[model samples]
Target: MILTRFKKGDLFVAVVTATLLLAAGAAALIARAGAGDPVAIVIVDGAAVDIINLRDARAEERVYASALGTCAVAFEPGRVRIAAADCPDQVCVHTGWISRPGQSAVCVPGRVAVVVRGDRAEVDAIVG
Candidate 1:
């Protein structure tokens, strides 16, 4: 039977298949971790209101119901965005997806700001 033959070609094929499987698994984990594994910190009027992990958040779309205003949020593999917002300007919604640490979406009218937190330095640095 072919199963009983331990040929060089067959051994190569088996090793390649196992390596590919491992690579795929690692990719999935990295996608879920996001770059730098930032945390989503919701700040209201300079106060931290909530904190959520961006990596684990992509399991499903969510809405950050705000008594101040309405903003629907969604999480994809390594990014998050305000899918919709009730703000008059729609600026927050238009801000689109944010994945990296220090990126943020602020809804001025809603008095809510979502910022990604991480260990990266110079998050607040201003450069030309």
Candidate 2:
């Protein structure tokens, strides 16, 4: 029996192809596992107000608290937005819905923060 040997270039290409396939498979698994789910919105005043089992949310819904003031978080298919706010700057309201994991909107004056929580934790920082 005769055995065929792979050249250096052929071996390199095979290795690269295997690595790519593995990476693709891993990414697909991650995406499937991290699929979207219903998230609760916690409005913190002097006391914590929990809005549970919220499936669909609208941009028109305005959230308010005595301590945190007023702010609105809009919900889309895969995201949430800050539609309005009682704060002077209104920056938080402008931030809009953050669908990705680890995304947040904060209104200091209103003492309000909206964050998207997901199953997989995201890295704190990304370096290019």
Candidate 3:
């Protein structure tokens, strides 16, 4: 019975669904295109400190930053991580490495943060 009624309403519904799916796919592609590439951004005390190009960084680098005390940032290839921190919890240091957009390690006590972003880059965690 239901299969027999697919002449008008069902066709409209199917067309609408296909259109919606196509629109969604196109929107996703546009967003990805606008995002460009992932970059490492370091923020300290609500300020950006460094913008690093992980793609261009062949040699591993250790970045030392001092805010409340001290923290070490390291990166290689396409990933960034917090190597160590003098803060009490050391949570930031345990975040390991991040390579994808939106991945981040934040130390509230030290006011330090490291994040991988899809566009642009910034640095942070420098007191002086």
Go through the candidates in order and give the C-alpha RMSD of each one to the true structure: 12.0, 8.0, 7.8
lDDT, model 2:
0.64
**Model 2: which residue pairs collide?**
80-97, 81-97
| Higher-scoring candidate on lDDT, 1 or 2 | 1
Sorted on lDDT, best first, the list reads: 3, 1, 2
All candidates' TM-scores? Answer: 0.60, 0.54, 0.62
Model 2 lDDT per residue over 74-119, tens place? 6655567678888899888778667655666777788777666544
Better of 2 and 3 by TM-score: 3
Candidate whose lDDT is highest: 3
Off by over 4 Å in 2: 1-40, 46-48, 51-62, 124-128
Order by TM-score, highest first: 3, 1, 2
Q: Over 4 Å off in model 3, which ranges? A: 1-35, 120-128
Tens digits of per-residue lDDT, candidate 3, 1-128, equal: 97876688789999999999999999988877745567788898778888886776565656556557577888888888888888899999888988877788888788888888765334332234
Of the pair 1 and 2, which is ahead by TM-score? 1
Candidate 1 all-Cα RMSD = 12.0
Report how far off residue 29 is in candidate 3 (Å).
Answer: 10
